[model samples]
Target: MTLSPDEIITVTLWGVPINATLLFTWIVMAVLTGASMLITRNLRPDVPPNRWRTALEVVVQGIQNQIAEIAQGPSRHLLSFVGTLFLFVAGSNLLLVIPGFRPPTSSLSTTTALALSVLVAVPLFGISRRGVGGYLQSYLRPSPVMLPFNIIAEASRGISLAIRLYGNIMSGAVIAAILLSVAPFFFPVVMDLLGLLTGMIQAYIFAILATVYISSATAPQTLSSPQKDAQ
Candidate 1:
């Protein structure tokens, strides 16, 4: 009846009911926020982008450029937010891959919170773009029947994002633990190599998916374009 070490690694904070996964997530978020602020505070747009600032700037600009390309307009201000989100999620997901550390993203609750946050940001951004009234009205357009379906569809994306990440990371952790516990004699070279590759890839995927979500969320819904006919 004893809990496994893995199970014991509950996503809880202070035993106050905050899960370990969520605690780890918030830590990642804080790191990203603070680091970004530190890098940005002293930045001087007066001159060309410098190294300390350039590296961060490039990351931010790259995201903004990517988003603008998709959104068809300048997104300078939003670049930092989008870039920070990607980095934070990637970092959180990679934590478990580290020895003795469990990635917060490997748990459903952790990823769910992250996904829901992103989803919520979408409507907020939509409102900022089209105003509260306009944003809500977009749901009614193309047909009211589609409204319910659209809402459901939007909800499903967040659940899917959260579940997919948790499943993959947890599966990897289980397989690795099994190998260590049952077959310690083996070199485990191939497995270790694969683990390294998978770890980095998983982190990247988590970040990439996050960026996509933000791009979709913060992106303006244009009524002029053929898509959605949102007007």
Candidate 2:
């Protein structure tokens, strides 16, 4: 069995090889884009909300609430970034039930890209909220001597996010493959259900961690205010 989607090349054009990872990533993006367009095409105050709109609202509202609770501030700014991350990861994993489908997230390259996006986003959000100088000064908190450690910590966050997601998704795929060979009957259904649950949980955890990291950079005082108030 192939270890990652990157290993499975689906096509080549002008010496450029397109792997399963790239193929499925584009597929996921296309699906999301088409769905959004369809759902919002008739969005009008005068028209009654359809089931699709209602479901979308519930999902968006849940994400907004989670961001507000974690960031302890307005969630509008973070919603788009965080929501996209959650949906992409969740969509990729959930689609694993499809026969012959390989989740792009099972590839380390894809996970690393996602994590790197979060890494870049944290600083952009930070600078946007606190300004470049202020965001830079966060490294010097308590003492200037701690700057090196803070910088290391910042870099490690992306590595950790990438490894955590890649390991979990890849391991799940490995386990399911092993089970399929050992007991072809009954295990497939069980593994599919378990994989669905695992995918959703991983997506939630990833999004929440990204939110926490961005919130710390964007609003450190707001993050700690609850503790200060309690004490």
Quick one: best TM-score, which candidate?
A: 2
Candidate 1 segments exceeding 4 Å error: 1-19, 26-54, 96-98, 182-231
Tens-place lDDT per residue, model 2, 97-160, is: 8987888999999999999999999999999999998899898886899999999999999999
Per-model TM values vs. the true structure = 0.70, 0.94
* Clashing pairs for predicted structure model 1, backbone only: 11-19, 11-20, 11-21, 12-18, 12-19, 12-20, 96-103
Model 2 scores a C-alpha lDDT of 0.93
Weakest 10 consecutive residues of candidate 1 by summed lDDT:
1-10
User: Per-residue lDDT of 89-157 in model 1, one digit per residue for the tens?
Assistant: 566645544555556666666667767876786787777776888777767767887899878877887
Q: Model 1, residue 57: what's the lDDT?
A: 64
Task: List lDDT for all candidates, in order.
Answer: 0.64, 0.93
